[model samples]
Target: MSHEARQARLRPTLISFDVFGTLISVRDSSYGAFERILAETGAHRVDVEAFWEHWEHRNIVHYCKPYRTYREICELSLEETFVHFGLTGDGRLINHYFDAFPRFFLYDDVVRTLDRLSRRYRLAVVSNIDDDLLALTPLQREFDLVCTAQRAKGYKPDGALFRYLIEHAGCAKEEILHVGQSQFTDLVGGKPLGLTIAWINRRQLALDDSVPRPDFIFADIQSLNDLVEL
Candidate 1:
């Protein structure tokens, strides 16, 4: 069948969201915390760009390994970045990121859009975060199903977390529409399972050539209204 024909036939009963970049506004608070951590640790000479590249890359690497608490993974990734950059920073500096979580807010469009989407579909959040950290954000009250890496004992792009969501949701893969910002995690992990995928390209990033194209692409959560009528 043609791609448009295939999508036209998908009647999603569950709308699953990836938190962080998708629902909550965290980039500023997260990076601000990281910068504060660097200053506090006296890592003044560290290359900011290179440090994030190494740290985030290490996060993906750690996610693929045996499950660890998200905080542990963050600390490990940051500590490794320190070593990779010849710095003496403490892994515990990741606490700054955690401390900033309470300050993170939902995007202006999120609650109104979700409220509308919920009228027609069950809503859920599948995130790569510890449950407590997720609880700190406004999103805690918003989802019907909450699947976190801590509960799954694994992370995304590996499929364990997505599978956990599928099992707990008790629905056929075709009934679920998984929305996320990361091509590597959401598209790479959810597509192979037969779940319909939507790429919320909040950053306006180019779709990576390595992953399969998503069933739909949108600039924000509000675009979900295009998929389902309220």
Candidate 2:
């Protein structure tokens, strides 16, 4: 049975979002920047598609470390990834990834939806990214509250990040609806914090049974716009 049906019922007063893949498409921008850096060497070649796969896994791995801002991790990732591929070790070329940080792809109806939703519900962002990286997104203007791992000193799934937001937002946990894509980050992290989560399952990937459960599910952020009107 679906959570919406099983629960007593919920009418969220505030909506929190996950920025990266949900509100913005950083995958292409991140990959393209890496591609340019790779191209500068001119002596190295790599499968661009494979680059994203390996890069994403490495990124997820970086989160397991003690704690570092996403930008720092990405900077290190750029250096290590290129070195591992036997590409040029030029930091300047790799630093371009950070230089072109603002080149992110915003999702459809984001501004429009936020514009509508903000009227009724508070809006916030609960992302796994660091302080600087999360601020780079165009959606910053649209958020009422912004919580980053740097401020929390821990990434998502650690629950510390969500707890930071709960305290910062000054809203009851029940009233806060955390809308995100990853159950690992959103559900597992926020669940313990007592923040209701709306799982934005955009990839059509099947949910792993072991993941912490979510309060609600949406196909994507596009579908969440209605929450404001409702």
Candidate 3:
């Protein structure tokens, strides 16, 4: 807590962010797409659990086995949900889900805050999405660097992606800060990679003392901008 130490973290040369829950809100866009999908396929009344919990669990398990795009995951999820609820997994419904899936509204403070911080730290996005959409689709303005599973050839919660980034970005382990919402992806995976990670605990999930801890934690992004000065 000395002025001298605070000065050191003032400007990191590089900061990487997780795309989905951290920088963009995919809930409305993704679920809305699924709503249309389920309706067209004559699916049973939408079970919220299918969309949020089961699909997420399924996707992570699927992605780790072999490479897949975020779009592909969405497609498979539609099939899985339909099968679980005993509905027809029609091709038309799957296509509808894919078409609407890419639309995501940015978080409230994303643009201004990123612009403000971009002045000081080189900003990049590291995500498990397909190389193109995951890194590029959501934003019109360019990021300094963007890394994806297609490029990294692997998924997060695996340290390889983060390690490749640090090597490619040409930054030291301690200087780079990673911000993400998933404790599994951002904290546990990023720990061995050696970056100082800030867990964006958006849902206010209780901390598990058992897991590897984050160097910094914020329940919401409101406090994110202040991190450059921490």
Candidate 4:
């Protein structure tokens, strides 16, 4: 551990993580799944990159409107993407993606970081995902508490899930550190609740002024352990 990690070892009682982008490489996994499905269907003309972007946009729109399983949002957004592209999608394609979701790989550093962090602090997950889908990920066993949008009936940026974490985990707002890759969902959303936020900028994206800045910014979870001793 570094000097900062040594110095900050005992403050937080709980550490919460945003699941999809922070721990798993959702973008890569989604793109690969889509690419394979399109290739199989001979939908070679579809612009895979553009299609995925539109799907993501639609997914976010649906996520904010009402409570739905993450799989349902994915299927709905995919159909919207198909309509936008003038392609009639088969239901099988949606199922294919859903099945592949659980298989999404974790970031190389996640397992080791979680192993170390779990030893020091109570670990929890605050995710935009549904309980079923989240259970499919390898991280299911690592966390002491797993709070999801499904259980909260709303997504991140809505605050329900965070409230659930606080109540269920029996931790005070200041005693928890929220770590995630999304500036909109995790950092901006959790900060106002009086929870310390750590922005895991795995992509090294430039900061936007409109979002609330995080208390700490790390290139990845491994670096986080360097600053806070897991």
> How many pairs collide in each candidate, listed in order?
0, 0, 0, 0
Off by over 4 Å in 4: 1-10, 40-42
State the lDDT of candidate 2 residue by residue for 1-230, as single tens digits: 46555454446766888787777766666777767766786744687657655655666677767888777776677666666667666655646666666877687767777777778778888777767666665665846788888888877877778888888887677778888877667777778777777788877878889887886777877676544344
Collision count of model 4: 0
- Native-referenced Cα lDDT, model 2: 0.72
lDDT for residue 147 in candidate 2, whole number 0-100:
84
Expressed as tens digits, the lDDT of each residue in 20-135 for candidate 1 is: 78888767557778888789879876766567768888988888898999999999999998888788888998898899888888888898898888887898999999999998
Q: Which stretches of candidate 2 lie over 4 Å from their true place?
A: 1-9, 41-45, 79-94, 140-142, 226-229
Q: Give the alpha carbon lDDT tens digit for every residue of 69-93 in model 3.
A: 6677756875776676777766346
How big is the positional error of residue 152 in model 1, measured in Å on the Cα after superposition?
0.9
Candidate 1 global TM-score: 0.92
Q: Model 2: number of clashes?
A: 0
Ranking by TM-score: 1, 4, 3, 2
The residue-level lDDT of candidate 2 at 161 comes to: 82
Report the alpha-carbon TM-score of model 2 versus the true structure.
0.82
Against the reference, the lDDT scores of all candidates come to 0.85, 0.72, 0.72, 0.80
Model 2 weakest 10-residue run by lDDT: 1-10
Better model by TM-score: candidate 2 vs candidate 3: 3
> Candidate 4's residue-wise lDDT over 188-207, tens digit each?
66877788888999999998
Model 4 residue 227 lDDT?
59
